[model samples]
Target chain A: MEKLTIIKVGGKIVEEADTLNQLLDNFSALPGYKLLVHGGGRSATKLAAQLGIESQMVNGRRITDAETLKVVTMVYGGLVNKNIVAGLQAKGVNAIGLTGADLNVIRSVKRPVKDVDYGFVGDVEAVNGEMLASLIHQNIVPVMAPLTHDGKGNMLNTNADTIAGETAKALAKLFDVTLVYCFEKKGVLRDADDDDSVIPVITPELFRQYVVEGVIQGGMIPKLENSFSAVEAGVSRVIITLASAINQDAGTVIKK
Target chain B: MEKLTIIKVGGKIVEEADTLNQLLDNFSALPGYKLLVHGGGRSATKLAAQLGIESQMVNGRRITDAETLKVVTMVYGGLVNKNIVAGLQAKGVNAIGLTGADLNVIRSVKRPVKDVDYGFVGDVEAVNGEMLASLIHQNIVPVMAPLTHDGKGNMLNTNADTIAGETAKALAKLFDVTLVYCFEKKGVLRDADDDDSVIPVITPELFRQYVVEGVIQGGMIPKLENSFSAVEAGVSRVIITLASAINQDAGTVIKK
Candidate 1:
């Protein structure tokens, strides 16, 4: 059974208490065939501002300077992780929120930048699928946050999409499930303004064409890249869709 | 295979970082099996004071009023939990910190006082052995903190020792391990002042005899009670010893 659905949830999708609860409810009713990876970028940025600290971003990823790293670690791995775990458990989802730091489930090498070395941000190097599959096999849904550690014992800020991709590939190698990428938008679209123009399917060539034609750019770039990575890494199928479309079948499917 | 070990660590264990690190380094390397259950009572008390809130205690248990509950939950379950997890992981120990609120591993029943209601303090009613054994079997140490919730979704302040006892009982039903209740004292003794007079062993009858004779009084009473409870629940053995003796074989072993 080498199949799994890796679902990546964006912070915006979980902004309100009701939305988070509703999402968990939909997830609980899901066919017990998916794993979830979550992002908390907006929440971390907002909290850092409230705490009077400036968050630095290089490209779309956070530049984890010491101060910013601490805030994000505490918020992403601690506060938001637990809240999501509690929320899903409240909805009878049997969710366990874990960080890459736990069980050394995900490991990485720390990336230091000019003068300002990020005290604890690492680029993920490995994913421990055995540990994760054991939990999922026992009927527990994992709610993973975007954080990993250097194998040498330092924490790091990682891209949630990348984490989800790696996790999808890992789970795909381990079980039979689906990989779902959930965001605020209503799936991939041919026309950005028309929500009804959802792309039903995508191929690697179509993806490149869409990017060059300006139909898929910005956030969609990394997501598509992640989807392609998962597909390449043995995940049989990948879904790029909206959270609202979880119970429906309106998301774009990427498969061989 | 009804064997179990319950190790109780105090909040002061983390307050003294160097000493705590040394202890963790030694404890993590111990040859036999073990599980660590910890208390953050002192931190909860201190944070409650700093917040200008009145702290309440009943029979040495912190009465978890709403404000105090919030402080303890954030400090113990968040900061303290992560600190220990980080420390253990740093030492190459695969320690996973869990709250009773997570996975419903340790469930409780709210025990509000007759006259004055303690907002969220509970007495242990159940322990999910299947969930625990799965983790332990995978070689991941379960580092439990005493913040649980009733199944109805309300949080509760549970006694750390009680949680440890229930956990030991659960593990005892699945594996052969000793339950060591470590604290500040060298060991339970006939006389309080003589550290050298550490009681080597005691049976259920002898423990009762000591209590009736006014030998085991005050703080030792609850610990002894927890020990006896674990013994009755099929744990292979119980020991009341100091944290410093974790690496050493110096402790009072309580047997069936």
Candidate 2:
């Protein structure tokens, strides 16, 4: 199987001109088949505020009302995604910007209201990995936006991390998949206060141990859980790293 | 050669749900390989206003200053384009939305400063028809947005009519291409004021005579000229028609 690197970048690195340029530069230099899954939450929030639409978040998870979904669709699917595609094109990468809706690549069901209705949020049910693998085989790099669709005619706001994990798990059948989750920190740190204390490798056991030790509490818990799930679900590896160091081997590598 | 239909729909039809559904229904029922190029000028303008950005139009052509360009990118590339893709997907047509920047399908040069600096407007220069025809052959319908790139990291506002025409001409080399321009009117009319006055068939000589007789004045002139140019450039036929009447053979057909 051919090697495929799926990098999931967050909003902060891609929303600004300088960081985007640098990120693209680094991304463009990667070898073999590559796919990018990107999030534009900050841009969406900023645009929503500009348009006088209030963004609601519960437990740090966005409550995607109809208007909020539109903001994300515009920001993630439109502005940020296209910019990345255009930037990669300028550097000679044959990049295609896509939401999960494009080509019916990923289909999701709308989140059924539990405690709160996530108006237009989608929980991905399936990913057409064969379709994506076919595109990658043709040397077309996919720059994905964190947006999905209900089989019915509706675009849904989706989490980028989930997209990356789901896509990686699907494509793992066809390729040697490495899913990279980029964040502000270098890696999962041993000491929360010390940014330089990067944990080089983590296994399923280490993950549980870290949580029990209170070293990997808070949001990092779920991120690593997804990473472990992806790896166990057939993805060869999952790395949590800084966006700038994607090409470098300087991140917490999750192993099964 | 296999048949290919390229339809260019303007903003007015697509910006609304009722008309968009009607148009999509008409489009999805069409036979053979099909592509759609769409404009979202109205949506872009509305979004700009909502964002507190002033839209400038010089002689009815938008002056795409920086802020306006961002609005268009969000509206055209994001909101309008994704909605169309998702709509088509719901109708069981595997559609992928694209800007020219995607796959480097179209490359344009920024309109140079003439009497008017049109900001980030682009003039169509090249179309990668081979690549597009391949996608069509694979049963992938491309829903194109009215956006192009300069091959230098910038998305430029482009005319959907030109995108449709250029794509048709390029694909004509590989397929029996029919380019359809959908407007408010049924087709090129003998009487500009009469909705039922569709000419049905128009040759270059007839077009010239219509212009001489003042029947083809105003914006209709450039539109017909472009249709004629597409025919001359190798497009098999060019049809000017209403969006609702796409599947029906009820439009003025341009021939060599």
Candidate 3:
């Protein structure tokens, strides 16, 4: 099987011009087949505020109301995604921007109302790996926006990490998939205050030990969990690292 | 050669839900390979006003300064494009949204300043017909946004009509292409005041005569010129018609 790298970057790295340029440079230089899944929540929030739409959040997760969904769609699928595609094109990479609805690559169900009504949010139901592999074979690098559809004309806000993990898991069947979660941090740290105290490798047992030791807490917990899940689902490797270090071997590698 | 239909729709038709749904229904019912080029200027203007960004227009063309470019990107590439893609998917059409920058499908030069500087505005230099044909062969209907790139990092505001015309012209080499311009009007009218006075069949000589006489004036001039250009470029036909009449074969058909 051919090796494919699936990189998921957060809004901060992609929002600014300089960082995004650097990130794209690294991404363009990456070997073999590649796909990018991105988040633009910060931009969405800012634009929502500018539009005077109140953003609602519950337990650190966004409550994507109708207006908020529109903002996210514009930011993630439009502004940020296009910028990346254009940048990569400038660098001679054949990057194509997409939402889950495009080609029906990802089908998601609207999250049912339970304790909280996360309006217009979607939990992914399927990732069409065959269609994606077809695109990859044609050398088209898909820049996926963190948006999914219910196959009934409704676009839903989705989590970028989940998109990356789910996409990696699905593609793992056809390729040697490596899912990389790129952000501002160097890697998972041994001490919260020390940036140099990066943990080079982590197994399932090590991940549990780190969680019990309180070194990995909050948002990082769910991210790491998603990474482990990808590894368990037959993905070859999962890396959590800085966006700038994408081409380098300088991140916490997760394995089964 | 296989027949391909390229439809260009105005922003007004896509801005509202009712009209958009109707247009999508009409579009979905069309036969053979199809592509859609759309405008979202109204949505951009609305979002710009809400964000306190003053939209500057010179002679009915937008001055795409940095701020206005962001607004347009968000509106056209993000909100409008995604909605159409998701809607088409709901109707079981394998639709993918694209800008010129995606896959380097359309490469343009930044419009040079002479009388006025239209910042970030691009004049298309080339269209990659082969790449488009590849996607079309895979049964993916592309929903194009009115955006292009300069083969550099810059994303430029382009005209929807121009995109549609250029794409049709390029695809003409591989497919028997029919370019359709759908708007509120029924067709190119003989009488400006009467909607029923549509000129049914317009040849190049008749088009020139209409322009010489005062029947074809203002915006209709350039539209007709584009239509004639498409015919010259080997496109099988160019139809200017109402959005609802797409599948009905009711419109002004331009021929050599």
Candidate 4:
């Protein structure tokens, strides 16, 4: 099977001009088949504030109301996604921007109201690996926005990490997929404040040990869980690192 | 040569939910290879007003400053384009939404300041018909937004009609292309006041004669001029009709 790299980038790397360009340079230089999944929460929040729409948050996660959904669609799908595509094109990479709804590549269900109503947020129900593989086979790199649709024509806000993991899992049948989560941090650290305290490799047992040791707490816990899930689902590897370290072999590797 | 239809829809039809759904239904039902180019001037204007940004217009044409360009990028590329893609997907058409920057499908140079600065507006330099043909051959329907990129990583506001016309002319080498300009009017009318005054067929000679007799005046003249140019550029036919008249044969056809 051909090897494919799937990178999920956080909003900070993509929100600014300088970092985005640097990130794109590394991304464009990456060898082999690649797909990019990106988040634009910062930009969306700024735009929403400018438009006088109040953004509601519960437990540090945005409640995607109808208006907030519009803002995210514009920022994540339009501004941020197109800029990345254009930047990659300037570097001689043929990149195509997409939302999950574009080819029905990802269909998600609206998050049902339990104790909290998340408005138009979606939990992905399916990812069309066949369509994605066809695009990859044609040498077209897809830059996907963190948005999905409920097959009935409603677009929903989705998590970028989940998108990358699910997409990697789906494409595992056709390719040896490597899912990378890129953010501001160097990698999972022993000391959260120290940049060089990067753990080289982590297995399922070690991940549990770290959790019990309080080294990997808070948001990183769920992130690792998702990564392990991908590995269990047949994805070959998963990496967590800074955006600039994409080409460098300097990140925490997740192994089954 | 295989036949391809390129439709350019007006902003009004897309702004309203009912008309947009109807338009998407008609568009999805069209046979063979097809592409959609759409305008979102109305949405852009509305968004600008919301963001407290002044929309500058010189003689009814938008003067796209930096701020206005951002609004259009969001509205046209994000809101309008994504909705069309999702709608087509729901109807079982594999549609991919794009701006000119995506895959570098279209490259434009910034319009030099002559009389008006027109801040970030672009005059299209080239369209990559080969790339477009490849996608169409793969049975993927492209839904293009009215935004172009200046090869150096800048997104410029472009006219949707020009995008449609230029794309059709470029694709003429690979396909027998039909360019349709769909608006509120049925066709080129003998009298602007009467909805029933549809002109069946128009030739270059008749177009000039009608202009001399004041039968075709104002905005319609330039529109007809563009239609003639497309015909001259090897487009098999150019149709001017209402959005609902897309599938029907009832519209004015421009012939060489």
Which model scores highest in lDDT?
Answer: 3
Q: What is the TM-score of chain B alone in each candidate?
A: 0.93, 0.98, 0.98, 0.98
Pick the TM-score winner: 2
lDDT of 4 by residue, A1-256 (tens): 9999999998999989999999999999999999999998899999999988898889777899888998999998898898888888888888999899988899999999999999999999999999999889888899999999988888899988888989999999999998999967889999998989999999999999999999999989988998999999999999999999999998899989
What would the per-residue lDDT of candidate 2 be over residues A203-253, giving only the tens digit for each residue? 999988999999899988888888888998999999889999999989899
Q: What are the per-residue Cα lDDT tens digits for candidate 2 across B79-186? A: 999999999999999999999999999999999998999999999899998889878989999999999999999999998888898889889899999999997888
Off by over 4 Å in 2: none
For candidate 3, lDDT tens digit of each residue in A1-256? Answer: 8999999999999998898899999999999999999988889889888888988889767899888999999999999999999999999889999899999999999999999999999999999999999999999999999999999998999999889999999999999999999967789999879998899999989989988989888888877888888999999999989999999999899998
For candidate 4, give the DockQ.
0.81
lDDT of 1 at A38: 80
lDDT of each: 0.75, 0.92, 0.93, 0.92
RMSD of 1: 3.4
Give me the displacement of residue A11 in model 4, in angstroms.
Answer: 0.8
Q: In candidate 4, residue A239 scores what lDDT?
A: 96
- TM-scores of the models, in the order given: 0.86, 0.99, 0.98, 0.98
What's the CA RMSD for each of the models?
A: 3.4, 0.9, 1.2, 1.1
Model 3 C-alpha lDDT per residue in residues B42-86, reported as the tens digit of each score: 999999999888989997889999999999999999999999999
Q: How accurate is candidate 3 locally (lDDT)?
A: 0.93
lDDT of 2 at B76: 91
Q: State candidate 4's TM-score.
A: 0.98
